[model samples]
Target: MSPLIELRGVTKSYGDHTVLRGIDLEVAAHEVISLIGASGCGKSTLLRCVNGLETIDGGEIAVDGDVVSGPGVDLVRLRRQVGMVFQSYNLFPHMTVLQNAVLAPVKTGLCSKEEAEERAMAMLGRVGLADRAGSYPDQMSGGQQQRAAIARTMLMSPRILLLDEITSALDPELVIEVLNIVQDLAESGMTMLLTTHEMGFAREISGRVCFLHGGGILEQGPPAQIFDDPAEQRTRDFLRKVSLAGRL
Candidate 1:
């Protein structure tokens, strides 16, 4: 089978400020790849490009062998197969967890309310939030809200899930709850592209890790090699500082 997603020479810029430079990467089906880098290294931009939220200035992006950014691709349809979770849980404050999770499937998949509700309830259980299904965002903790967001994404039955630092905005204690939900998803075969600073989680849960620096992937490999014996000096320095600080 072809790659679930591919980025070929993908470059992006906001006028003179180049955000991404000639990125080439591939994500296989059911694979989890974590993109780790400094704050402005374009990891989120790259994820946005994959889901068609950000258009590329040059190069091509394809999902499951169909070109998304180049000629003859249906962006709208492509996005339906890709779901994105944000750093700030973007739940509708007015909607309950079940409503939030079922809305997209009911609207886009044209499923009956009963079917959507069933799927949403199952997903809530998957994220360990079954009992809180009737709660609104305001009533939930940051971690619960984020997990609800993940369940909302899963309700779409996406082929790929793009996570843009989903735990960055959470409290330290809440971070593990959200990460645990992600770990469950990975274990159960969800294809995920994540931008995160949680190195321990990335190392433990990811199939591969890509280190971005100065707008592109400076180094990438399996967690053990990339975390223990990175080849690039930039990667080594960044890891050292992050590791040291993590100890504090």
Candidate 2:
């Protein structure tokens, strides 16, 4: 079967600063891939490009064999197939958790309000936030809010999920709850591309770990190999720094 997502010579730039340069990657069905690198290494930009949140300067990105990077693409359709959750929870402060979760599906006419609410409730339950459904964002902890954000995205039933540092904004104590939800999603066969600072979690949950450097994937392999025995010098150096910082 063809890959669920593919990037061929994908490139992205902001004026003279290129974030992603000729990035080629393929994500198979049900595979979990994690991108790990220092800041400014293009991990987030690559995820943005995949979901059409950022336009590429060169090459192509395809989801299920349809090009989504170029002009005339149906962005609405593309986004529906690829759900993204960013570092910020992005929930409406005034809306209850249930309302926040169901807003997109209802507004997009993907389902009736009743159906959206039902699905939203079910997703909230899956994320362990069923009781918080009636609570507002400010009433919940950072972890709860992020899980609600995940639930909101999952309600779309996208073919793939893009997570760009979804736990970055949370307190250290709250990070594990969000990671556990992601781990559960992985176990349930969700195809995902994530950029995370949590090395141990990435090592445990990702089937393949990619080390991005200087606007490209410097190295990629099974987590054991990539983390324990990287073939590239840059990969080793990056891991050493992470380890020294008590992050690995």
Which predicted model would earn the best TM-score?
2
The C-alpha TM-scores of every prediction are: 0.96, 0.98
* Candidate 1 Cα misplacement greater than 4 A, ranges: 70-73
Residue 227 lDDT in candidate 2: 91
Scored by CA lDDT, what does every candidate get?
Answer: 0.89, 0.93
RMSD of 2: 0.8
Structure candidate 1, residue pairs in collision: none
Question: Residue-wise lDDT of candidate 1 within 88-181, one digit each (tens)?
Answer: 9899999999989888877875588999999889989988999999999999999999999999988888889999999888888898898888
User: Where does candidate 2 have its weakest 10-residue lDDT segment?
Assistant: 196-205
User: Of the candidates shown, which would achieve the greatest lDDT relative to the real structure?
Assistant: 2
Each prediction's total of clashing residue pairs, residues at least 3 apart in sequence or on different chains, is 0, 0
Measured over all alpha carbons after superposition, the RMSD of each candidate to the real structure, in angstroms, is: 1.5, 0.8
Cα distance off (Å), candidate 1, residue 152:
0.4
Measured with C-alpha atoms, the lDDT of residue 126 in candidate 1 is 87
